[model samples]
Target: MDTADAIIVGAGHNGLVAANLLADAGWDVLVLEATPHAGGAVRSGHVTAPGYLSDLFSAFYPLGYASPVIKRLGLGEHGLSWRHAPDVLCHLLPDGRSVTMNRDIEVTAASVEEFAPGDGERWKNAYRDWQDVATPMLDVITSPFPPVRAGLGLAARLRVSGGLRLARRLLLSARELGSELFRGEGAKLLLAGNALHTDLSPEEAGGAVYGWLLAMLGQQAGWPVPVGGAQRLTDALVSRLVSRGGRIVYGVRAERVLVARGRAMGVRSAGGTDWRARRAVLADVPAPSLYLDLVGARHLPPRLVEDLAHFRWDGSTIKIDWALSGPVPWKNPAVGRAGTVHLGADLNGLTRYAAELACGELPTEPFLLAGQMTTADPSRSPDGTESLWAYSHLPFRTAWDAEPVARQAERMEDVLERAAPGFRQLVVARHVAGPADLEREDPSLVGGTVGGGSQAAFQQLFLRPIPGLGRADTPVDRLFLAGSSAHPGGGVHGAPGANAARAAIARDRALTGDLYASAIRAAHRAVYADR
Candidate 1:
């Protein structure tokens, strides 16, 4: 038998979560991380100043607050505490005005009413309808994929009257849905900006659902930040995993997955050590790197190889952090108290920003997603100062010079100056992490495409990475896609890793001994044949 029951490649948050579950259930688990740290996008460090802790990647997590998995893990006991700002999200408009949404429904409705007279009633009506359908959808969507039983349960739900109405909207663009819901441009811009959180355009298919989901979540739970920093969340996860007998080895990268008899056995580290597994091998790495570069097509089905070829990554983003002398002190004071501040006035601003990014031109006036991260948590910096971080999505893999970050910062200033004049005066020190810095941190980010493969309509759900299969089960029998590229896809949710773990458990429990050979043969036929 192998050294452990399972070998997890990449000690990212998702892999750690899966390892924790398996280990807690009495499986011996070993985690190998390419980087020297445990957290991937969840990393937090002092990049700006010595005492000031800056989030290296993802900072605020609304998902963290809402995820059942995190709650089940007892993360709060393990050092995960949340700090929420006054408002959920703030949109700093270019017309020298701003709108802030609160966690309470009536308060949020009133905030929107400033822009549209009776739109508050319309907003409430939309939310009322959304609530009827969202609770059930949230239950299933966020839950781990159940086998055939779960599928039928969801199918039954969709057959119901309320679910059918929601499903119809899922097929529409956020632009269409927002336009139908509100008469004011302010409300439309808010919905549109929220939809593009994954960097999907407002006009893109399947974008509406994200807007609806996030808006609902924002209403339900204002986005929250971890008390100590995001690293505390990682530390808690790692602690829980280790407490369950899962071992994590830092600074180890998987060079290739070990395949035998058409089944994944384990992985070969770049350091030239071979580790074997008795039950499963879960990879939290990106799709192309895991399938093409590391494992190669010899061990993969031909159609899967083609699907890997066609996999699309959500564009790159530039992450910037600052150790400010004081709070943002925005000209519009309301936005300063928000955890997340979206900066873009009207539809034209966003469309122009998208056009410039598409045409290989970083906008002269960029749209920024700014977060007053430290204001939410006092421990992030000194008592008087506030820590700030922001990122702007860009076209994927755009080739640029060594100091493109400096240019991007110049444009970022334009966004900040519009809402918070003299923003530069507030900066004590700044740290910039662009595409190159991102790739350097983790090759899986792949030019700062943090969502793994794109969340675009064609690359999502069952169609993600490939059609006919979306639940982490790859064409290779025991091999599975545990990264965000898999089903229920990206974000810091850890669903993909959890899905892969459950899939592995099911496959192992069923077929009694190695089902690798039989499963691969069947997968080959299904993939090659037309759906």
Candidate 2:
């Protein structure tokens, strides 16, 4: 039996962040990862030819760079350097036009003016409104729910009517917001395409918030990539955790959490190895995996178990990575300057794509979120050659056998070819990952559903990952879920893990912790009393 003050399952970036923070506070921490390597989805590898670094899953990190946890950890000091493209993102329109989102607000606004003359000023005004509330908004999203401080600060800034207006805007779908705000396709595509980054469609309520937040964040922080590769970010995080006296055990699958007297004691691996925790156990796996699989339905309230049955998962995805012989020969040369590009979709096209997904039908024209690694970081590949990666959402529960996956990859290439005429010719070698492959690589991305689960309005805020208060504390005492499935769901931001650590630390400390625990218990009872 192994023993530690705390045991963390999953060595993903979020788990690593939690371990670092906990170990820094003098708790002995042990992280068990099922994969041989850390970083989970935030991994970089050479899937194609030599001298080519491909981000196996997630690539660009706008949320990572903007994350408060990352800022506090100062990953830059631990050998993580960021590289930004000349432009943050480019949305290539079907009609041979494009809109680029630059780091500078004025520059981005100017690009919006290309489609509709006065809409440039509208873009500027919308961004200004975002700026006024950006700090508080980020605070609310990243903090533990019932965000008292963030709520108070935002209220102080917005007052009553402004807050109400903000709430109304949050309720709007991406399509609605775009139609209401801009008359041209450029700005509309920019917002709608970003919304598709998640599983949400243009028409889904609460999709507008994602579009607005991502676009504004791009303006604030130009969707930067790690200097070497996505692995560099993970390397820095692991380095920091090791420096802080935390140990990570690789290739250990946690089969079940060891519980005693309704309290989490630690975890037992599939090999029947027991790693005991003197204080707490933090699970960085998905909500379903943590609660229903490892912890088991027997321990949870009956109602919570029933709710888990209906827990919605985001759409699966098919990703394609290529080792290009040269840069993508975009018809619009300016598209080459962007780190990220949206391909084969305008506003209406994205809506139709979403509709197809809703009907569980493969889209005829899938929208692609493509990344040009060399454009952002020249060292990602050999000079003049580009490392390109793109992914499009698939219908949930789609059959992802090899043949189907290959067909989707080919379709994705077709979309890219249409956007950049010579795209197919430039591909020296390619790698494709279907939903099944993704699940095999990272179990957290169950069914290839990213962002934990769906970030739809019903699954957001306090209602995320099975209701109750929007905190990291789980139904069982001394156990916490610190994954993307928790509040402030998804993205590379380590808020969920950080929040779990904070809650655990608060409970371990005396005085105020007692009152805090009491309140949490009361809230939990109230939420699940009937069950």
Candidate 3:
């Protein structure tokens, strides 16, 4: 008899989403997580003092707002509640000027006016053109990407005015896009800062796409955070699974997906317990860990092995967290209320950061993506304190010790200090994590490539990770890839996981439970019998 309908590895939001869907369909499901907690990078905790809730990794959730699955699942009823900041984000230039974006198009435009007077009107034009393509643009981005069928579908769906502009937007680098869309330096910096959220420099192609998309989406949905914290989102997902009779085991790692006769059975945890699922095994882990380490080499196709060998992770990131006595007091009062704030010296500074990383050297002036949780929702911290977290891209494989933490963080503080002088005096506590810590906490974060590999033109769309394999499926019949590596890459959307579960369930019906179980025993016996 099948132990469960499906065995899922890693209880990240995607894994949970897949498990919940399977269970709701009346199939028994089991989810196993390596860490002591579920949610992966979406976890939230009080890393500081009592009552100061800090999101350990991701803070902003534009992708979460855009996710079709989140709506379909009705996660809000469980524990997730969203709060939006009036000003979505700000880019603090070295000269103390800032570029801010808000829902009111004219108001946001006025902020752009700081660098150049007429640029505000020009920016409003960009937003109007953006709205024309927003629906289809979202379709192309959120759908299993490079779905030629989907792309063709979108091309047909858009009848709005000037939809052709998205085609042009695709061709420009972030720098080019910013320059063409707005004449204000602050406006250009805001776009560049938004694009860099993907770990790409403004100079990189396709990077600018996010700048416009994120900026526009924020205007539409607002840069929202769950009222309690990011964990509330994860908790809601897990609750749905439990409500459906699904089971989850935290602190459990699946070392391999046992296979036999060219089909998958279930998974064997790193601790040596074999959880047999006679139906299917869906992995919500990274591609490298799932394909090479968990699934083993013999079952994989030769071409797939080659693709795995060449797969690229974006770059490393340095994260700094702080417990502050008060909200970050931005000298410019307007920017103080923004949820997400970016700090950079100049346009050249950003280029240099990317250039150095491309050349395998760390930049002197780092590009920082900082989040002011308390500023947006004061409840995240004590009544008068701020719980803060920030991150920035570093050289792809840089081995950073405590030294770079000081160097990079000092620069970050310098930006804030310039914008809000004496901001350092309010810092009550601090913790900094290098790339190694990020990878150690979650192997999927491999090399701190937060975007689930580069969003580079070469790696995006049908070409992601490798061509012809973006559906969360592999050569192995019952094993599936359900992480950001699959498609609609990164952010908090669980579509990749949902898509994988559907594929696995379909196959489960085709192949008998015993066939899957036998495969697991055989694959496990062959690999582990020697000991």
Candidate 4:
């Protein structure tokens, strides 16, 4: 039996982060990965062609770039180099006009001004608010639930930043926030498009939070990609972990979490091999997989088992990767400079697309979020060629066959073609991954819902992954939930894993370890008491 101080059940970025943090603290850490590779969704490959690299799941890293949690890791020392496009993002309208987000606030302001006079000042004003609260806001989002310290800082800043007003705006739907903030479609489209980066729709409540956060982050720090591919980010985390004496065993699936007397003791792999974790076991899988599958429903509190049944997942995704023979022939050259592009006709078109998905109808006009990898990082493809990919969402658990999935991919291509004429003709090779394919590659992406779980208001903050303290602590002692299913759900940011690592570290401390463990146990008991 293999033994370590901590056993992390997944080699995803989150698990790697937990291992790294623990190893940094001089703890023996072991990571178990079901797949042969390390990255789960944060992976890239030559899927389209030998020379063209494609990000298999997530591509751009705006959150990763903005996240102080990830920032503290200092991944740059581990062969991680970030590359950005000329512009951050471009939202191309059906008529070929594009709204580009640039790192320069003035440039982005000027772009929005083209749609409506005085909008530039308004854009600048919004960015100013972002600058004011950006630090504390991010801290609040990334820190373990209740972010006591960060919350106080945010509150102090919010008083001057229009406390109630800013709070109201954050809870507003993307459409409502856009309508109230910007007078024209350009800024509105930018906000709404950014909101769609999550599973949220234009009209969904609380959509503005992500919309504002991401759009502002784009202006603050351009969406960057690993110099070579998305895998480089994972490689850096793995490298940092190994440097700190962490070990990862790939191709081993964690079948069960061994709990002795309500305390996590070890993990049993699919091959019936038991690996002992002397201190804790952190699961980087989804909530349901961790609680119900690995830990077993029988061991969980009845309420938690019941809550797991209602866990909501974000929308399923259908992604298409293309090895382009040449650059996308965009109708507007400005669109070509952007690493990420939002494809939609207008706000109304986006609403309709969202509505169709909400109604379980296959959208005739899908809203596409696309990436031009070569433009962002030249190493992704040949000199003259472009490595591109686009993705659109479907209603969660939507029934579909291969034929419709193919049609869906074509629809996505059609969306791209409208913005860039002859787009399909530039395709040297193509690869498609339906919901099943994504889940097959990474089971944590349940049904291909990329955000781990839904980002709905009811499931956010303390309510994430079922009602709790929003910390990484589980009902079972010494077992932590260290994935996107935890607080601040979803994104490339390593908060979930970092939180778990912090919790594990706090519980193992000599002076306050008992107190920390007792407090966490009490908190978990209260949270699960009425689940």
Q: Write down the worst ten-residue block by lDDT for model 1.
A: 143-152
Clashing pairs in 4: none
| Model 3 stretches with alpha carbons more than 4 Å out | 145-153, 159-165, 508-531
lDDT of 3 at 96: 74
What order do you get sorting by TM-score, best first?
2, 4, 1, 3
lDDT of model 3 at position 358: 85
Model 2: per-residue Cα lDDT over 436-476, one tens digit each? 88989998888888889899999988998877787899878
C-alpha TM-scores of all predictions:
0.95, 0.98, 0.91, 0.97
Give one digit per residue, the lDDT tens place, for model 3 in 1-531: 227878889888889989988997888898888888888888787776677788888888987877777778998778888987768888877777778888777778888897898898888887777776676666566665445665776677654433466667876788999888877687788777777888677888888787777888876777888888888999999988898899998887778788888778778877678888877788877787888898887887656666677887888888888898987887877777788988765787788878887887666767778888987777898887888878888878735676865687787777667778878999888777778777777767877667677777777666666655356657677777788887767788787887787767666664575565455445434433432
Prediction 4 TM-score vs. true: 0.97
Per-residue accuracy of model 4 over 21-64 as CA lDDT, tens digit each: 99989999999999999989999888889899999999999889
Question: Measured by TM-score, how close is model 2 to the native structure?
Answer: 0.98
**Looking at candidate 4, what is the lDDT of residue 104?**
91
Candidate 1 residue 321 C-alpha distance from true site, Å: 0.5
